[model samples]
Target: MSHPVKLYVYDLSNGIAKQMSLQLTGRQIDGIWHTSIVVYGREIFYGQGLTETVPGRSHHGSPVQIVDLGTTDIDQDTFNEYLAEIKEHYTAEKYHLLDFNCNSFTNDCAGFLTGGSIPEYIKDLPTDFLSTPFGAALRPTIDAMFRRPTPGTTPAQVPTPTPVSTQPMPNPELVGSILQAVAAQAQRTGQPAASTPQATTSLTSPLHPCANSASFKSLLKTHRAVVACFSNVVTCPPCRVIAPIFEDLAHKKGLKSGGGAGAVFTKIDLATPSGQALGSEWGVRVMPTFMFFLDGHKIAEMKGADANELRTQIDLLLYQAYPPHKHTSLSLPAMQSLSLKPILFSQVPNLDAVANKLLSSITSVNNSERVKQIITGSVVPYLKSRSSTKALPTVLVAWTEVTSTLSSSLPPESLFPLVDMWRLALLDPAVATWCAANFSSSPLVTLSRVASKLSIQQCPRPYALTLLRLLSNAFSSNVLAPRFFIGNFRLEVIALVIPSLLHGDGSVRNSGASLAFNMAAFLQTGRAEAVRNSNGGGTVKSDMEDEEWEIEMVSAVVEAIDREKTSEDVVHRLVASIGCLLRLSPFYDTQVSSLLEVLQAKQILKAKLQPGQCGEKGVEKKEVRKLLEEVANKLCA
Candidate 1:
């Protein structure tokens, strides 16, 4: 027996604009087509977990439901706003579920709401459910919306003028006469016209107008348009006429479009613009430019275009990218390439740029496989051949994007080239500043990139303190794999970052302690020695005494810790690292005396008594005093 399907009306305005009916399929049916539901007006209830058991069910279960009234037609702006609200109101997984369900109502809604968006807010839910009946229903709507044309008045049609060939004719006499007329014109204009064989007559005669000449009449029909003003490049009259038409068309397409909503089409006029101005301003020297922009920033472009050719290019571009009205903030595919899981490395905002460039280069190389010698050359380098400054960053950024796109391991050789590219970016003060700025904004992402790069042995120079500091900061936030870095760096990144704990900046202090805690946890064995060797280069000789290495490293860490200020909460971390290190195999017992010296130097062992902290007459005055007494006894013993 078929269950009666119920209609779920969705009203997008108040946030709940749709209703879905579920039929019980089994004894205990739980899962349905989950999507991100916007529970705008739903009453939210929060309570602590119950300790006692319910009468018939497990006591562990908590009852909670996010009720969304319905979902309906929403423009891109409203859609983003809705999504942002949903993200704030629910967990990413929950929101992702809601998004899937919401998108399934219509194809346009699916693409509009989920397209080009970061799933950080929705990834945990079962993406497979996106194909469910609820999900399937929305697919058609999303597809339809995404397929809608970008708003622009249809291009005014122009009459197609007949094509005239400039090819030469076979008659020698006709060619001779045309040549003489060309010479006569050149003579009048005080310019020399070179002699041509009679067979080349068609070229010379086309420039002259002779009423009685059949060749001249034929030339008029053949050359429908002539250059009004001669120029070496594409400013010939016919091309110039077409250029403005394209410019106008691009402007109309770009009128209301900008930002990540979608790119707009624009034109950069070369002739109306002065010498080197267009090239300098827009970075081009060619004519008949056609550009695609997002919020006035040029992202993709072409130059030296004709009418039919320009139309083809526009169609191709539109096919690849949706218009603003049809777009969501970001595409799912593009956003996935930017996510943490598939990248295999830690996240870095700068690496996002790198990844994008790599993907672009890969695409270009693959696309041009069939047109090598005809275009740039068959073995066209995967990277661009522009000057080093232009090419290096592009290639590195591209590599980063590609690695993020590909879920599996990339070749070591492929990464070596990117390492060089990053090295170049690091050396360029401006580029380094940019990288640092991005790190500041998204520490987790930046730290992940650094960690991944290190894992691949990509750091070319002595690891900069700045790079280590960034990782340390990220570790402090507990936003990255602190153990990976702590185990990898030879020098105690924690020790260096620990001083930040005492700095004037409170955030720095917090970050420092975090780094120290994780670093201590990671330095379980002789990993520090390996790290030291990697960074400082065998400063500890292979033949050096094992006991001596222990003493040196312990002393270094203690000294670094002791240098921190009294107000800083670093003593706890220092003690923790020391405790962990001692518990690990290959103990550094010789450093015990050094550690005591450093502790004493910082007056860290000094006991303090608060007014209300006194113990009974027979008891120890303070915990520290009792502990110190025991320590003194041991040292003396």
Candidate 2:
């Protein structure tokens, strides 16, 4: 049997490019093309990495055009292997809008599967757009829009466009004359003119030479751990031998670990006058001497060109700075192997039905019209177009206002519809990013207010369930999860979640379990990454690590497991959360392990795993029982 392969074409600009291209650029561009490959009943696309979904269900929504690219005889397993290889080359970090994008991925896949290419115009869109004078002028704007998020800053920090009147305008007549000249030159020479060259900023490596005492002092001040090599490569043979080794370590340990958040490696040339001044100041008497500085103070010094000793000292410096978590030494294979991806509830209900329910439930005549406009005009369209394009700032601001208003004015019982809407919107990365950056003003405030109401008042099940789901969806943003875990709002969010674990309703309990799992997964991922990157040295403590938070969370989960009697699904998830929280925990010996012992977690889990005591039947019950056994064994160990 053979599977049919197809090409899905989307308009990155919707229909605006077709409508405005001639007037704006003096060219007839059909659309700003984005594409994906459809095969084996799945739509595979690239943006934030290569993602697969059901046909017509990607964030891009329905494709503007679909091209049949014949059939492929390759089996699913074979194609998957091919996809794995392709994934390495098309990673989220490497994604570039104009240079390399969705169309590039699809075109490659299409050629491999069906010996065909995506349309020439689609493949050449970037070149065509850049060829225009207006497009050339707009290059920097486009680059700014699509630039990757910096390590320390969120994407929300990127500037949005201001009003045209606020900025200086280019001369239309001059632009027209330039375009005409290029066209006339092309006609005369029977060839197209070259595109205007674009300027690119070059990145400097983490390992570079320090020229002076000021530069050396600045390096030590800026970095937590500075590895300074006092060597003149031109004069000394030993310096030449150790220079490459130092550079290799710098690239590996310094650059790879969160962009030099770890140790920074630099060398000082003794031959130079400034380097000589720095050497005399630091008392560097020997050539090829290595010195380690932690927090701007000299910690250790080494002489001669010993590569192994250099590597060892650097590792020791990192270890002293960042001790490994106590749990890393434990033999908890099951916990160590747990997935770190968040547990998200992203099933979107019908927007029309949700909107209708919200409108019908708003009893206040004064606020009803305003809420309606916000939902139907702002929220609905934003959600609808979110997969295809970024939402306008006005829409997000409108959402914040409406959510705040509704949470304040509407009864707790009548807020589920609004909460549900916000939950659905958080599934989009843009909305999630905005919510994270504007934490105080976002729907999170609404969620917190509702949670506070639940703490005191009798809240409706639908509202509670939707609220839990909303919290789970908030973990969808990589930027938001860290803030949610350890930011100022951490305790408030945790307090809201703990009680829900013991809710009477099974659905509420399940949703709460999902939320717990997300929190644990976030914490676990940080710990795991730190351990993996530590290379047998002491692991750096994750920002997500909080002794109090982990202890509180694990204690609640164990209690939830003891109380949960009906749903095996809920029990399984609860166990997973416990496993994640306990694994690679820095406070395992001092706090978490003792807390589990005090809570009688092993006994509770042992009771649950006994023959018929498990909630579910067949394979589900078997899996839950198996997980319970694994957790119980870890406790014993």
lDDT of 1 by residue, 1-637 (tens): 1111111222221211111111100011122312222222221111110011221122112222322223434454554453343332222111111222232222212333232221222222222222122222232222222122333643222212211121111222432343233222211212232232111111101112111112112222322121111112344455467645554544332211001111132122233322223245445554545554322333456555466765665554443443221111222232122111110112233443543333434443433333222223211232233233544444444434433433123333333323323433333332332332233222224333543544412432223223434444332221122223322232334334434444444344444444544554443322323222122111111111244434544454455444443423344444344433333213323454555565562233222122222222222334334432332333311
Task: For each of the candidates, give the backbone clash count.
Answer: 56, 1
Cα lDDT for residue 363, model 1?
A: 40
Find the candidate with the highest TM-score and give its number.
2
Worst 10 residues of 1 by lDDT: 20-29
Candidate 2 stretches with Cα past 4 Å from truth are: 1-205, 208-226, 255-262, 272-274, 277-283, 292-301, 316-333, 376-393, 611-620, 635-637
For model 2, the run of ten residues with the poorest summed lDDT: 196-205
Cand. 1 Cα-lDDT: 0.30
Candidate 2 whole-model C-alpha lDDT, 0 to 1: 0.69
TM-score for all models, in order of appearance: 0.22, 0.62
| All models, RMSD in angstroms | 32.1, 21.4
- In model 1, state the lDDT of residue 435: 36
